[model samples]
Target: MGRLCKLHIQNDFKEFYTPQVTEGGVVCITRCDARHKTPLRCVYGSCSMTRAGPECECSDRAAFWYQDQVCRSRISKVGVAVGVPVAILVLVTIVFAIVLLRSQRQKEEYRNNLRSRSELYDSDDGNWDAPQGFAVGNPAATWEDMETPSTSYINLERVDTSRNIHIRRPTVVR
Candidate 1:
């Protein structure tokens, strides 16, 4: 069998490709009857010099760069004047997505911290108090673990009987 990559041409495997360079808008073709084993010197419609025998040296102008067969190169929406801004916009969107992903990671970390704290409280002993730190007030004072009465739930009847009602609204100080 022939090599897996080698082609078995039925009719010379003739294919056509546009030449690279041209005067203005001319379409060029290589010689159809080139006898060279290498297709390198087989540019179409080239008016320049020919290579020696077995060299098959085609012109560089009609290579990949000039394969469109036109003097001017091809330009798409990506390279067009209006396309630059669109590319910049897409890049900005990607940056925003990255930033948002980073923020979500931070949020996930905070959520994990909260979950751990809750777990600590739900343990067997059931006492997971907040640690001592520089909170909003009284940073230097220590906490007293002595049992205290429910001062926050004072009886309203006792206060009503003990105190007199004030008639006027409190005055604001500037």
Candidate 2:
């Protein structure tokens, strides 16, 4: 009995012998070897302890514990290890989606701008439907006339009392 008492005191002095009542409960801790198939039997009152179990599991053991099933330190560590990376990946995916959406919107805006500019360049007369180099009205003006580049004139001036407002007149000289 002296040996058992000495062993228990040596193993659980800090948790059981200590007078600081951390939590009210009978906490059992044991170090049982699976190969030996040793049963954990506390001859004295319970206290917190660490040890190997009947299975391949080794962790802190408790009995009549008020809290939920004690998740071992290793399990909590593994959870943290996996959870952090998964959260980061989710955040990255969200950011990538936002960037992709923004780029698509910018591309659509650019396409619309190009379409508006093309419409502006389209001639209002029936000649717009005619093929390139087709002379209208005057047959004397041949393809050579169409090839000639023309100067463009633009007039810009403030239209409103506010500096924000302006008017522009664009004339294509061809």
Candidate 3:
């Protein structure tokens, strides 16, 4: 029976072998073949048999990933779809904030310049009186006095209708 079992084990059951027989009976040692294994089905991927056991070879297509021995995870796709727009929005917001801060700084600098100019023009007597044309609050104080150019009328020559009349030249030489 042992010889018949050994022949059967070698020729028929390539994946199984009876290593030792104890009081319990025959000890069958099973080789790992992922395709025949019932527990490691690898539903979404192909199975590869290794010394450590069966390993799943997941698909390499985009937006897919292997997790828990399966390749059906969509977290990568969902994360990308939601993350890109959020990233762009954050970048635009940062740019807008920078632009707003720069404009505000420029305005403050302009105001400081105006204050300095006013201080420079202030009288030493502490009176509100400024130079005649140097008043800071007056809108027209900076206008230069100048005379407007006079408008001139042009005279046009009148055309005579008699000068436009066509006259026939003498056909015969005088």
Tell me how candidate 2 scores on lDDT: 0.44
Best-to-worst order by lDDT is: 3, 2, 1
What clash pairs does model 2 have?
27-47
Which portions of model 2 show Cα errors greater than 4 Å? 1-75, 122-146, 149-174
Best-fitting candidate, measured by TM-score?
3
Tens-place lDDT per residue, model 1, 63-138, is: 3333343223434433455678888999999999999999999999999999986764542322223332111222
**Residue 109 in candidate 1, Cα distance off native in Å:** 1.6
lDDT tens string, model 2, 86-107?
A: 9999999999999999999999
lDDT of every predicted structure (CA atoms): 0.43, 0.44, 0.55
**Clash pairs for candidate 3:** none
Candidate number that wins on TM-score, 1 or 2: 2
> Best by lDDT, which number?
3
Q: How far is candidate 1 from the true structure (C-alpha RMSD, Å)?
A: 18.2
The TM-score values for the models, in the order shown, are 0.29, 0.35, 0.38
The CA lDDT at 37 in model 3 is 33
For all candidates, the clash counts are 9, 1, 0
